[model samples]
Target: MEKRNQKRLDKKMLSHYQLQLLDDEDKRSVFLIKLTPLNSLLFFTFFMILITTLIFLGLKYSPLKEYFTSPTVENQAAYKNQLLKLNERILELENNLEANELYIKSIQAVVSGNIKAEKVDSLVVNKFHLNPDSELFKPSEEDSLFRIQIEKEEMEAMKASKNTVPDAKYFTPVKGFVTGKFDLTEKHLAVDISAGEGDVIKSIADGDVLFSNWTPDAGYTLIIRHANDIISMYKHCAKVYKKQGDMVKKGEAIAQVGNTGELTTGPHLHFELWVQGKAVDPEEYIDF
Candidate 1:
């Protein structure tokens, strides 16, 4: 066991640390160092994290951050909720749309003269295909409420009212000279067309005879209501051809010119036209 102050160093290996045995323990040598590569990697990772944090803070304070982040996570979450609500609303609207479509179809059929208008009224009254408790009608509107039976009667009457409309050709009621015009202030709702005494009075257009009667103001009156919202009246007639309900055509002799009615000045024909509860100028179309 040769030992000189413990161990000896080799001078040839100057670049490396030389360990010499101390006493009788040459196998036990020590070197003090903690310079592992892991420490370097740990430091580098730490530095990188700091840099990333700085960048995040900078971006958060920047004005352009709002533009980019607004449509991102938070915004996307809100948009998702909104989209769900919108989908629910759309489903509800689709259901209502289907019901409305059927209602419109029914109304169209009625308007086309296929189904009567009264049928529609009944459908509404009975809530046949509607929510009875819906907000579409308030309880206060009960005054306007009509039963299906009454509605049926109203509908029947309305259907009968179809007879009220007169044809377009029946717009003119006389073929004579206009001696007077319709004046509301004068209380004259008709025109006095002076025809030759005993001149043949023709039916202005096609219509069903409503009456062939005498009135105090209108001596011999013949009222005809035709289709298409038209009506004609002839007064001061000495004679009448067709009676009530007789379908007369235009130019058909219906009466003879005569001096009648308190307002009539001579043996002229008092002709008039009515439309929708109002009277207009008859000379607008008739050549005479």
Candidate 2:
């Protein structure tokens, strides 16, 4: 009896349980699996370890990690970059506004003839404040070439001044009688010459036609730019023979006399001369 009991205990320790699948009606076993107590414990332990490892891998590498991260911290870097760009744009706009204001003030000064000599001197000094002895301020090859050209021009101008004639030669635009004269006080900056209708008018000098257009006050008008900063204007014309930008020779026919514009009472030519932006008496330079 003692021996049999010991045998039974050993068999129980190594015993395997049989798992069987059987047809319900025939009661015949179709599949079977055997698992000992130790084998079952090992299989369960391996499955649990595998499941834990898979869960850890998914959280580490997949998008599920986003849920655990703080969104504000992640977006803060992007926001900082945008803020930096905005600041740069604001600075650029401020600089542009300041430059435009300075330009407008300069134009106003020129138009009102209020630009002071001190202002000009200050501008020059401020623009050229760099030390002349510095290597960075030294002239390049291009600058040397430009300086030579300017010096040559200055020499030519000096020679021309030495040989300058007492009177400048100018062709009479037309043979007519003067009805109105230049008077700065009255704001009549031009001379009105009366002649027969359709009388041919000529250019006083070789120049490029700057303007050729019609206006309610001047009617058909033409302006020419010549050398030495001289400009001539012809107004109240019956017809213009040249277009804007056309090169005209001295004594070339340019227009015809006419009684046009609201200010005219009869057929006449209104001619004006400008030297360096100031209106001058045309009779002083050219005969009617």
Candidate 3:
């Protein structure tokens, strides 16, 4: 009876082991793990949520906030200041360039334009100091216009002492066709004639050589003083035959025609007649 009972117990343990090994959909074993696909998905979702939350909180309180705001808030002020300063500097430079351009233009005009200024020790171009608020810059009685009147008065005073002939007999210093006629209203006191270079220049009447020298305007000039306060001026000559103190006879060869003066345009002679210190028309006495 003991052996029979031992055998029956052994058979019963074997059947229980087989039953635990087989999968049962209806009746699962209690006190045993029951893992499935749904359980795994739930676990993974919880882990992901916890990790994401931890990361978001860590970054929110860190230096990441300042890093993001730097380009918009702190740096913007510096960038704007730099940009504005650059614009202002460019504008100032542009203004300076314009002023320089105008100055260059004025210099060019002065260089190219020509004027036969009178040969006297007059004032050359120089800067004059004047108040910006003064009337000297304006045109009026007390301004440049008025100053011009004062200058004209001064000119008259000086001219009163200058030697000008008005009534001397007109003489053709050179034999040539009249290149230019006299215009009285224009204050042209001389007549121009086209003469051959080195041609003989004859004195119109008896006179004493007053001056024989090179001038800026009259070129190589010869001035003769005659009786009755009569004077004659011969300009644009190559050679002066008489000296300053030499007396010359009428129709005598006194000089050679040439273009020597700064005012001469070409080979020509400029002749002037004066009596009583005033200019007289050359056409009145000479048949040119």
Top candidate (lDDT): 2
> Candidate 2, 33: how far from true, in Å?
97
lDDT of 1 by residue, 128-187 (tens): 677778887545545455555576775455333432433333434456778887664464
Cα-based lDDT at residue 56, candidate 2: 85
Pairs that collide, model 2: none
Residue-level lDDT tens digits of model 2 in 58-111? 877888866775657658888898899999999999978776456434323422
Worst 10 residues of 3 by lDDT: 115-124
Ranking by TM-score: 2, 3, 1
Q: What lDDT tens digits, residue by residue, belong to model 3 across residues 46-138?
A: 999999998787767877765554466657898899999999999999978776455333322322223222221221232345687876556
For candidate 2, the 10 contiguous residues with the lowest summed lDDT are 117-126
What's the lDDT for all of these models?
0.64, 0.75, 0.68
Model 2 residue 8 CA deviation (Å) reads: 99
Each prediction's TM-score against the native? 0.41, 0.44, 0.42
Please estimate how well model 3 matches the true structure, expressed as its whole-model Cα lDDT.
Answer: 0.68
Could you give the candidate ranking by lDDT, starting with the highest?
2, 3, 1
